[model samples]
Target: MKNLNEPTQENVEFMIEEIKVKLRMATAAAMQASSFTVERYEDIKDLYEVVASKEKFSISEVEALVSELGQLRK
Candidate 1:
């Protein structure tokens, strides 16, 4: 979305924090194993794109989706 251009500073920061949250959940589920997989990377990229476009999210819904995506990664 947003023509695939770079996000604003606020959006970039938000995406970074959101990605960290998702990564942490994924890593915890992986249980000391590697969580850097194609699916995980795609999840990060897709969510970043969404956030960059919408610039808004419902915390509960986003966290739930993030958790599901974590499971999907591996």
Candidate 2:
């Protein structure tokens, strides 16, 4: 596993990719890791943790998460 404690571009990319996979996002192709930055690392990590803890999610939950991610984007 990658060491995600550090706020690095690579770590951000890893977390974003993992979140996308875990969420089974239909628009995963549109949400590239390059769209994110270390400036929002903590927010992204928080979202990643929320996503990682759940095996499934309701449509509303997914929408909310996606919206949060959109807000965090550069």
Q: Which candidate is the best by lDDT?
A: 2
On residues 5-67, what C-alpha lDDT tens digit does candidate 1 reach at each position? 443444434454555544444444333224434434445557655644654457775676566
lDDT of each model, Cα atoms only?
0.49, 0.94
Q: 34 in model 2: Cα distance from truth in Å?
A: 0.6
| Residue ranges of candidate 1 with Cα displaced over 4 Å | 1-18, 21-34, 39-44
lDDT of 2 at 2: 82
By TM-score, how accurate is candidate 2? 0.96
